[model samples]
Target: MLRIRPRALPVPATVLAWPVAVGSLALAVAALVLHASTVGGLRDTTNLHLADLWLSVLGPTVGAAVVARDRRTGLVLLGTAPIAVGAVAGAYAVWSAEVGGAPGAAAAAWLATWTWVPFFLPALLLPVVLRSGAAARLGAPVAGVLVLIAVFSAFAPGPAGPFAAVPNPLGLAWAPWLGPAAGVLIGLTAVVLVPAAALLAVVRWRRASGDDRWQLGLLAAGEAVFVAAHLSPVTAQPLSDVLVAVGLTALLGSVALGVHLRSVTAGLRRERELLATARETERLRLHRDLHDGVGPELAGLALQLGAVASRTGEPVLRELEGRLREVVGEVRRVVDDLRPAGLDASGLAGALRERARAFSAGDLTCAVEADVPDGLPPAVEVAAFRIAAEALTNAARHAGASTCTVRLGTEPGSLLVEVADDGSGIRADAGPGVGLASMRRRAEELGGTLRVGAGPGGGTVVRAVLPVPR
Candidate 1:
């Protein structure tokens, strides 16, 4: 069953990203063309000609970066939509202004003023995505986007910047009451989103390692430099633009690196899963061979030995038969260890419930709440089951808890397993034992995580987040 496998994307990244990229390239090419045709390209690249350069490659590249990754498809689309829109609007602004009396020039000019908005908004989600692959919610981020649009819609700035000495076509001509709302937006952005983004970046930085660490770190770093350069002296436009260009290039490069790394990691994970599946298949085959092929033969040998022993009263034949019985017991043990008890009859959730039932007693009570779907990858299922079992065992025997709850659920691209017990909490100074270590190993082996610590108020909590193979 392909339940956990992601449906194929209707459009490939190369197909979508390339055309958009080419369009952005056309923007830069157009900016240069219009620049050479007139004087505004180099004289005022930042506002007139240079605005198109920002969108030249960076905007589309940023959009492409998010598009190439399969995770959070809708959010990625929503987050990146502004890039192309801003680019085209900026390009149109340049083209119209060059033609002197070109239609819609005023509107395009006003729209171009906010070309920097799209690049700023995705900052809200970038840190969160780096920390956790999933975006927790869309409400706040969407609201932020709307607020940005509303600010531009409601407030008409004086004749400056992209307005090009002309009134803004989008903003209301004059509205005294709109300032409070705009003030509120600015304050929230500065106080809430900025600090929150910084905090998330720090948290994500601390959590990520190896390629992940550097990739997201480079993104943060590159964007910081770009922002700093944007705020630099206007007199240093040439130097500032260079810094901005480098920073933007770095941003695109980092995302590309991340996508490449994710592809490689996913491929390796699939290979490992295939190998594990093959190994399990072999285990089952060996179990069958021993059960069907060797069992009868061993029984026949025992029967002959017993008959000879009975006829001649030979002690050696009796001893040989006893040894054969021990070998049979060992084989059965191996077969049993190959799979969890009742795992075949009952799925992961059912096995969890049975394990929960086994742990329940007068002194300790166990409960299970599960929401796992069918057709989960076998490796993911086995890992979840084992992690849950170990957690349950710890709760039952070690925690001395009155109540232990096992919760199994699914997150966007992963399985969530949590075991919380209301016994004495894990000691602050105590190190992780073999059980904890084993659970961590299992989760990490599947490209996930396990967290064991004191529960809220009291007792121990075991949390494992395991990636389900797509």
Candidate 2:
């Protein structure tokens, strides 16, 4: 399997990220301000530290957003660039600490939770969702629900009923073992969750797609409800042990459904994508066959007929030669109609100029103006070239065009290519010609656009604009 390189964030996103960081920093500062001015300072109550810790937790999400951005933009080729997973984990740890700016129990817990996201995000969610079929798509929502559940469980308002915690840790019956044990339990849950999710994702990706979307949804819904029950305001008991059992059962059921559906969907989507690709490949092959085999055979037969007409020197020779010439010309036209490999080989300018020159030698004129830098990304180059070729081809073959001008250059932060022809005006609704359709597809696939309309002095003009390299 090919590994995809994640991209860098866009300019707007890069700018946005710093503000999020600054906003988080401001929150910490506000915590400090509130801490000092209120009833007591940092030494008096742990709430200030807790506030700061929560603010610090926001930092890793920013970092996670950055990681997500990298994946979105195709900049994360680091999968092959010798970067170790531990290094990524360490970086997140350091970033979390720096963002925290101080150490406390709450800060530690926040840092630990925030840091867990990156590892689990890619290792767990990415594998299952991206690689899985329909289940993977549903996996995103499921994962979101789970995270929400966890957050709700962690921060749910304490002690609706009598069994809730005492105000201070010192006087509580189980404070000594309970606090540490709860922390340990959370950590252990994370350890188990990460590996289990990852393992399930891997299995699903490797499996076939007969998975049920509804079952997955039901399981997710059930877990959400189960988790909600414990965290609900109406819970009769403050520390209901029964609630824990119900939540765990729901969690176990959800996981089982997730594992099964994930495998099936992954298999299904993979097969469907493969089939689509294969179909496209077959279509291309058929096009090649018609162009290479049938078209040439027709032309060869026309040549043979022309030879017979000449050798006989009959009165019908001129008529025969004319008919054969027309046949050969039409054969050539059909071949050209079938494919435009010239555009692929020589760039758009060369192909357009060749078409223009072939169409008109004296009364018609054609020129190519190109200022493209060397080594433009191949996809961009191909798209630009094809648009130019299509415009010129349409003009010469259909529009009775006399003059054509093609230009390729950079405009602002975009690559712009335009082809204009002085010919009969084009249709308002361009017909679905293969040439036109191919040009549009090429443009769109590269995050660019194509426009064709009337030229100022009658005829048609085509333009393509694409993003410049970041």
Specify the highest-lDDT model's number: 1
Off by over 4 Å in 1: 1-14, 40-46, 49-52, 71-121, 124-236, 341-385, 392-418, 421-432, 444-448, 465-470
RMSD of each: 6.9, 17.6
> Could you tell me which 10 consecutive residues in candidate 1 have the lowest summed lDDT?
72-81
lDDT of 1 by residue, 181-261 (tens): 555666566446655664566566666764467666765664465445544565365666676556556544555556567
TM-score to true structure, per model: 0.70, 0.33
Q: Model 2 off-target regions past 4 Å? A: 1-55, 71-292, 298-334, 341-347, 358-365, 371-386, 389-404, 409-416, 420-440, 450-470
TM-score of 1: 0.70
Q: Which consecutive 10 residues in model 2 have the weakest lDDT in total?
A: 73-82
The clash numbers for all candidates, in the given order, read: 1, 11
Give the clashing residue pairs of candidate 1, or none.
45-50
Who wins the TM-score comparison? 1
Encode model 2's per-residue lDDT on 368-458: one tens digit a residue.
8877765555445555666776777787778887788888888776799888888888777766788878886666555466777788888
